[model samples]
Target: MTTENPVHLTPELVENPVGAYAGLRTRPGLGHVVLPGLNAPVRLVTRHEDVKAALAEPRLVRDRSTIPDSEMPDPQAELMAQGADGLPPEYAQYLSGHLALFDGDEHTRRRNPLTRAFTARRVAALRPFVEKTARELIEALAEREQADLLGEFAYPLSTAVICALLGVDAADQDKVCGWIRDFAYGDGSRVLEGLGGVVQYTKDLVTRRRAEPADDLVSALLADGGMADDEIVTVFFLLINTGITPPALFLAHAVLALLDHPDQLERLRAEPELLGRAVPELLRYVTLVRMGATLYATEDFVFAGTGLRKGEAVTVALFAADHDPAAYDAPERLDVAREFGRGDGHLAFGHGPHYCIGAALGRLVTGVVFEELLVRRPAAPELAVDRADVRFGHWPGDGFHLLSLPVRL
Candidate 1:
């Protein structure tokens, strides 16, 4: 067993947390624990079974209206999946349109267009561009003998793809990237502080897109996304700022998992097709974005033999649910070869009507990027970097961090 006290908080877990989690899972489930020194009653759902049941059960909600914003909801699950502590009006408005934050048919509507645009076929069409981009980036890194994959490659790659989908200019890419960075790297306070700048940028872009329409989603939205400037500004704010935040962090986590599992890496290279199935598993393995938006129970519901309070906070313990052994056999094991054959499912992208809309986009990016990494740099050098050096935003369940790898060329 690891010697580090579970009560002690460290940046290491925020970077590569599988070990810490494995230890945590072994502890007794019914104990009430404080987050470091915080005075909040938190129920840690470490076992695979408990996490799974909690996620599927409707009694566990996400909306902040159900829980007091100032009070942290069990620090064990950090990084507010909804909108951090305290839902500000502008931020709330921004989140209302983002498909991940919304529920019901409304989310379906905003998602439909993008969904159609990113079918398996569409993602396949993107392979060539992805390969080309990855190849060039790797070549540059190999030449330099070192690279910050998160900042240098992953961030630009994902952001560029999102922009292309929205019809934003490459010139606007850096400015747009700033919002996601602040959200990903900055704490809860910084997120609110940086919101105004992101909103202004999105609003300006919308104004331009409205006056001079283009063949992008923004134009289509102006013509069809079914929202005016005010509404468009809100969605745009979420798209750049909020939506990109968690994903950026999690993608880094997935990459770290691959780096740690060399055998799995080789297996992936042998059969690239496994990527489709493996993406979900990888999402589960890291449980990086520990939870989804805290949902508020609209009506009375009973689950797991527990009576839930109405308007009580219902949260999908995403990390818990994804890692739950009930859904995955030997949940802790990173088995790339496991067929999983078939099963219930994972909470990586959430569940029910509120499922993640950008899920396809994220999977597409991660999978394609993985394939490209193998193809571009087939050298397969082992990473030589300390876990502590790879730090991330200090939040419970935070993912990724400063991953600086020194591998043999």
Candidate 2:
């Protein structure tokens, strides 16, 4: 069905998604909006309660195969088919089957091994290393009077940490980071090629890990026999891609948010321990990974009193849900000390079975990066560019990335 006045997910809305989300919340719980590059209308779940309930609803599945292709929007299939051409059929299928696209037992099977690898103990064990990496990056930034924090510090820091975790070589970091950056923001014309490069690189890495296992997450995953070589490659690609960008964006966003709220910044500086509370708040406040949690209805179901036909796409606006007034007090404010223990935690990492596996690590890395930057930096960083001048771009479904965040140390 076509929308009469559909809300397109444009760059402007992406820049200020919360504002759009707020307007949507005023409507009925589940409303329809037409996104660009798609032929069908998407059921946008905006309210906090409905969003939370929808995320956990078994009727809304991730696997698209459950529904006939002709029943859904053409863009849905195009998005899945992306980057699959010119590759072996098996590899192509693997490329399309990311963890987020799986549900039920299949999702569990694919996700369990990785979940085991990123246990709390494992994340905690990496604290010292994360701290060391953050310190080095901050030190290098200290040498320069002015630098783009996103380019110079956050990106490299995140890439280095993920490389260390995945057992990727230091020599190949620049190459990998470049590929990730391109794939994250490259226009449609080049994204497929960029993804091909990443897939090929991951294949090589998986082969090397198999031949010579190392003390890293990739080697550990290889040691586990449940996943195929292609599955391993896809999982590795997802891990590195997901691991690097969100945390990097979060770091920049956290810094930007804190800087904007000097009172919170001073409070954090005065009490470093407040980070236990602060990090969660930043995760909620920044909400860097905006949109693109797409799910399909498995059968006829009533969602928020709306009759969702089979194969219809449901896109949850997490940024809007996190800012819902019913969920939190002063939802728009960036209160580092806000208490989140009482209710459902922030939807930044998402909700339900497909919740991000790298969440703990992202938090650990971000927390360490913020702690070191605040504690070790000789002076707090001031924006080198005007706040209004900051530029943003999104790779449709990946992240709303800051193209540049120049700052004076």
lDDT of each: 0.58, 0.76
Best by lDDT, which number?
A: 2
lDDT of 1 by residue, 250-323 (tens): 66666777778878877887877787767777877776566455445455565443344455344344665555
lDDT of 2: 0.76
Off by over 4 Å in 2: 14-18, 36-39, 78-94, 170-201, 342-344, 397-400
> How well does each candidate superpose onto the true structure, as a TM-score?
0.74, 0.89
**Cα RMSD (angstroms) for every candidate in the order listed:** 5.6, 3.1
lDDT of 2 by residue, 1-409 (tens): 2356667666456446457777877876567776544445678887778878888999888777867753665335655555454556634664566888888999999999888766687678778888887787777777886888887888777777776787778798778767766665434465556676778888899899889988788788888777887787787668755877678778888898888999998888887788888988988887776664678888888898788888888888777777889888888888878888653368888888988888888878877877788745656788887888987765543336677788887
Give the C-alpha miss distance for residue 126 in model 1, angstroms: 4.4
